[model samples]
Target: MQHSLISLSILAALASSAVFAQEQKEDEANDKYTDRIRILGSSDKLRTLGGAASLIGELELESFEFDDINRVLSTVPGVNIREEDGYGLRPNIGLRGSTPERSKKITLMEDGVLIGPSPYSAPAAYYFPMISKMTAVEVFKGPAAIKYGPNTVSGAINLVTREIPEDFDMGIDLAYGSDNYTKAHAFHGETAGKWGYLVEGLLTQADGFKTIDNSDADTGFDKTDLMAKLKYDLSSTNTDQFIELKVSKTAETSNETYLGLSDDDFNQNPYRRYAASQVGLMDWDHDTIQLTHFIDFQSVDVTTRVYRHKFSRSWQKVKGFGNNAPSIQTVLLDPDASGNQDYYLRLSGQEDGKIVVGNNDRRYVSQGIQSDFGFKFNTAHIEHIIDAGIRVHQDEILRDHFEQDFNMLAGTMQNPQNKIFTTVDQEKSTTLALYIQDTIKLDNLTLTTGVRREYIKTHYQNRSDNANAKDDWLDKEFSIILPSVSAFYAMNNDWGLFAGVHQGFVPSSPKQNDVDVDAEKSVNYELGLRFAMQNTSGEFVTFFNDYSNLKESCSFSNASASQCPIDTDFNGGNVDVYGLEANLKHNFALTTDLELPIVFTYSYTHSAFKESFNSDFPQWGNITAGDEVPYMPNHQLSVLASIVHGQWQLNLLAKYTGEMQEAAGSGVELSDKVIEAHTTFDLSANYSLSAQHSLYAKIDNLTDEDHLVSRRPDGARPTKPRQGVIGYKFRF
Candidate 1:
């Protein structure tokens, strides 16, 4: 079946290319009179690439006041974002059908630079850029993402920050919503002669809606962000050069938890929290500094950047109820079961439960220097655009973890242990990467080919408190080469076709107990078509991924002993994933001179483990041949409609997420292990009071429907209730 699909895709591409060639030849005489359009860093160029890509600009971001990336990304086809925390503090992003845990399978960036705390050593996204402060977002999927990095098995997501403006400008935004949610964002920028500067700050806080039935602690978060940028332009009679310096800081405190309620408890009160999780909290701080230089020449453009980033976080949460007790998830699934009743009673504070609290404290630092050169020239009637880049990076993670035991007395945590136990686990890595790609353009056809080389050296150590315990450092080295090719043909001004195939790569989890593992590798293919007319535009794409090895890591903090040994790894030998994505947008003009815009997006994904032989990982429990990959919905759909008048705009958005299995299984037969399908609607309105003033209002989940969002790491969790916000913006 897969082979037949591949053949049909190839045939379609060839047919389109032949038609394009004939059209080009027919219009040969008028080629000289046609004007060429070029946008250096624009969405049009990205969309026409031989793969699936989408650029969400400021206007689209403001349409619904979507500060949460999951909500904003729903409009894009083939992009899947899982909601963990009600707020998008840490997004679990998946491209195509890759795993979405911690967003580790994909490449994440800010301002075109890798933003992971430790991209090379510990790629878990403990810290994410603030989406409310970003000016734009760029999503690159399929084979084109090979240019980004060592974790491109999925794709790449780039957050574009606000840049220094060419002229003086100032703006302020304020909003208040349900749950006492408040936000304030302000920014100012100016350019004077050869110098330009910008400063921005954001503050947001909320009093959460969920109730801690046994405690008075606020289940909310407070966050602050500050950024500054300086730019200098050096323009002379012979050359042009520019330099930019940027610094940013972020701090956040949230009372969050991974411990959820039992099925009965959830049914009674979906927003209730267990007393054992009263101490669950996360506090973090991040700082970054970057310097970039740009040089422009007659035929080439060069850019160099040097950056350093540091992050520190301390998350204190309930790790376990007792040594011999059932896991939180097991008790939640069947609280009345024989052995689970006792555990459920302990979690409810009716019994003496030795609650284990772990202080997961960690610090990370990443620094790198990278440069990119782009050259454009023409030779033998063919235009060539070549891009090459190289990077050297070093990153590490330092951990100082400790734990304490306590008991809940009369619905209150008491009898805390005075003695605390500690352990250390650290990892460091040094990496070098180089990549080059050339795009060849001839009349109506364009071909792009690229290759990347990566070399990495990693070291890990585990320190024990016992004097007799053995402590030694282990080292490992890896080298990988990846290549890709793609083609795009413009059949005419209104029709086009593209296709590409590339190799995907992802580094294995850090060594565990002196066990070295091989890296995960896959071959990915994509074929798509683009169509645009006077008032309509759309794209349809089909993608397939063949994985040689799929890997999963287990953490003691989240997984139970029955799931997998702590700090162990599980490999799912081979897998196959295929999907289809389609998106369309159209504009209609009314008789009253008003315009209405409609947008539609849909995706279908089918992923399965081809040769499943499971070892002890609960996520891949008793895997069998043709078992579907967990947590990936087979169908997703969204629609948007907007009305535009003189100075007012209104939009209505609706989204549907199909049912999916919560664990690796043949089908969704078990209710506890299935995430049911759900639909949500949103409404937004914006009005311009004047040239410098505007007002906006948004209401999310307008129907106030209750639904389960996830059942992972622990027990089932519900999505946030309806929320409404009113805001005002001022500009000068």
Candidate 2:
């Protein structure tokens, strides 16, 4: 029975080489389409996983109907998120004690494949998938993380999409909300003969919640996503085999900016955008195609996946005033400090001045092929299951940046200068990953050991008009071997304990000079307990990461142009991070027809540098032996409660995120100009009008709580204000 529990999601894909590939239904084992990368979405699999993992299923995902990944992740322990844009667009996410900047320190995937724009060259998720169309989300951590690859320092996240149905089915969801927001989502799936197919589409648009100075321009965004999947079973081959093809496209246009309000301006109106930022905007398009082949033999299983992704993005936003060299932080922190008065006045549209804007245009290509093999054997009284995989991935990033000078006349642009090339560059990486994991089970104990080998060759070419970058376009290569071990012991049918240790690594960006920076390396450890009693079940885990050499990658999304130059690596020396994660859930029977379901999650994280150092990297500047890491919260908590009676359900959620620092400093960093602690609540009510129709109403930030969310990459930013929405759903 234990061997039959197939691992899908991260468990199979474990790190870079898939181990369990999928979870197969005993009855549907012959139809590879029936297998799912569940990511241990069920409690039973998680209890014996020998690691820490969480699954957000359809029931919970549709409860709040959250279109934002940040809000949804709050309910998972050990996750840290930094909110921006009020919406979850371009989310800053972290697991355990990893940096939450741009979510580059972890592995991100969709349906068991890497999904970041350029996971190997430019990992920043400037274009994340639409969460509204996802059927489930899986979070993986601990030693198991080593099985997932590239950035095992933190963890991994996999977004699972809807699968082709076995029977005819279709559904549609429509909603209207505040700020002129609108959403439409529809999906259809059916099986015919030996073929199964699914088609889905989603559209979301909004007028934005921010007001522009002397302008009525919308600050919101519009996004569209379409996907189609086709699968065919090859029963005619006289063996259990199937092939599936998936194709998807996404396009978006958002009027967003990196510029935030000054401290004084934010205090007065946190939602106001300065006239200088009127040019802020971004447009992007992404397309992906994937093909998968599955074969089930008498003694082994095989899964082969081939995927390719192409993405293009163009963003135009205010760079600065005049020379565009002065740091925005300097002027915003003290607008009346004589030297900053002119910049401040001009920013607020109170004075006519020349402003500079820049356009960041980039294209990305990511393609890879991976194969997995799994088999079972027995030796004496012990049983063993072995999973081995190989993957070859190549990704590239092409960058072209331009800047122009503009004259601001009375809060409106007057004359504009011709665009000039600022930077032109390209980065590429070719990676070969091989991994194998063995799961040994004897009685009530399950033990797993795995090793992953990585070989990466990278190249960077800079063709900037400026001399800041080298033109050599040199290539560099690096290789490493990582090992992991974990075990789970069942104390009884209701209690289990797990522990693991693994070697973690994160590769340097292809643009790195190699001589100055070594790839990030660390040893990670975790221990936990799983318990279930009646309708109550919970997990408690503690993790620690000891870094021998930490590295920081700078990006415009989290750091200033002057703080840390883009496409560069900064050495962080030695460091240590430790944390605890706890999650509990229970259901109470109120009556024969009513029930109450509750879930609670909490996270505590702490980090410290081993040696004192000074650097331009904003988050790690002037680090001391005992100084805490910036942007890392000490406490995070989330609670979800819901009542179900007949065909009616009501849900409430509360989240609390502790204050964070813009830069590493004392524990009271918030005392300065850092983000302050904040709490928010959300409510949702849903009623099923027969089995074919349903209605729902929801409100975000129900308490109208106002708080500062960040202070870097510009000036000051705030959380979203209160908003509400109503929707209807139809399914047959």
Candidate 3:
């Protein structure tokens, strides 16, 4: 029934939807006329940045047909990812050495708008846009990332959607693969007179690869996405203006569990699912509506957006045999222990017992209005671009969490007990933010200066409180001011230098604030050298983030939570994270009609706690001053190569993620807490049937590499096995 949200949006739109760069019309340029919805409007905007940025252009994305955000972002430098589900239903992305848990440390956006459920109140990315539907991806780091506050410590990513075509245009794609994976994508867009519109829909489903004990349930997931956009153009001689409205809906249902296997059990079969997890399931729906107005007056322009998004979700997963029992991880790690073997026996259905499952029902609302004013002027023959912006945003989260007890008979839940309301958490945040940035250009030197100020107000109610009295609620207020400066110098056509320094901040959750948890703050610095040569381009950069107070959040999703309260913060005092990134790209011409392009990216990160502290946090147990940060791999590398010939293209990509520690420590890594290193390769081929039709095939995990990706929440989790798919696409 949750799928009805998108269906309703379609009816309301009966209303309104660049699959790729080469597919767009050359004469119709959205950038030249109106204000852009994208952060980096074009490749030309990248040049030599005051900071570092990456634009995964349409040419590359369209060629790869990557449905997973993790796969897409792995090609970029300075990005670290931890794979959870074989598919990227939930992505853990970290910029530099920031935390990669649920991507809460980084800012996520679509078309320049915050896309998280409730960015300011609850930043966990339970709802992420489909990657296959995006046209381009823009990533910003360092000082330049401050513009997208409340989360400036890690950085920001913008997912660009397709725009309406100049004329009538439409496309359809269909594919089927291993494990009963299927995909259907279609879109249509057109322009008439001064009005234009676009409508699009996507559906992907699969029969999960894992087999559950004594259960026939489909362990996979099904997802649906729908969108509508309407636009009215009001343009004249010296001015350009337009009003656009966008509506979108996303829904999903997946049978996933946090239960993992013991090391001995994992060694026998990595993909096995315990019988106790047969009841695990999750359902979620999200809806959004946004209106934007843009107008240009010669050298000055103004653009504003008003948006509201709503998200609701419910996840029912196994808790344990008893409420006070040890965490699942504890038992899975040492099943031979006297107290742990019984839990393990019940999990495997070897003995009948009562089971407890928790259902976290959550609702989120995020609404905001933001505007930007741009000015272009010249002073003393020097060109300058000035931008100022202001935003007033409010977001809230309401969680109605409860648990139920069930009698398990042969791995299936029977006689369920009455549901118990375990907790009710309500939190909200309102923020007023203002920022101004100036870009000065003279000769071959460019300098950028920017400052941002934030005024935040928050309210929270203590968990498990049933009273409505004002005394049961807590309110708090705070302010933060951040400043940044960066410079770029072009020594010649082949070489350039860039450097930047900025203040970074990530606010604690509203409830966390009510508990007097301190927000995270840091001073970040970066320096880089860029070069261009014959048929090749490359860059080398180094970055350092010195945090006066670093904060880590603990939840059942990424860490063992028995030692600490749920959804609480742990202060990691005085920490420094330093890293180096390198990237190189080159194009080789095998013949006049055949061309090969290759790209490589590498990153090395080192983190240390400058002050020793004692803590019971599961992920940071017994921290020493020089102990390394957990879940941070010291080395990462990615390589992408494509062979293009007449009417055909073949692509191969391989990535290596170094070993990581589950808990913080230094010296020779302990054997038990280490997540071993692994490398995987993917291959794809595309053949053009005509200008309007194409055929493509791809094989993921070409070598069927089975390796532990993480040991979090539960036990060992493995990557996807080898899977292949063939598909056809049509466009006009």
lDDT of each: 0.80, 0.85, 0.84
Q: For candidate 1, lDDT tens digit of each residue in 289-399?
A: 999887666466677889999999999887676567767777878889998887777777777667777788899999999887777899998999988889899999888
Off by over 4 Å in 1: 1-40, 418-423, 468-472, 512-516, 556-562, 565-567, 666-672
| lDDT tens per residue, model 3, 217-282 | 888999999999999988665567788999999999999888878888888998898888888898
* Sort order, TM-score high to low: 2, 3, 1
Q: Candidate 2: what lDDT?
A: 0.85
What's the TM-score of each model vs. the native? 0.92, 0.94, 0.94
Clashing pairs in 2: 12-18, 12-19, 12-20, 12-21, 14-147, 14-148, 15-147, 15-148, 15-149
Candidate 2, residue 375: the lDDT equals 79
User: Ten residues in a row with the worst lDDT in model 1?
Assistant: 30-39
Q: What's the true lDDT of residue 225 in model 1?
A: 95
Candidate 1 lDDT at 614 equals: 43
What is the full ranking by lDDT, best candidate first?
2, 3, 1
Evaluate model 2: give its TM-score. Answer: 0.94
Measured on C-alpha atoms, candidate 1 has an lDDT of 0.80
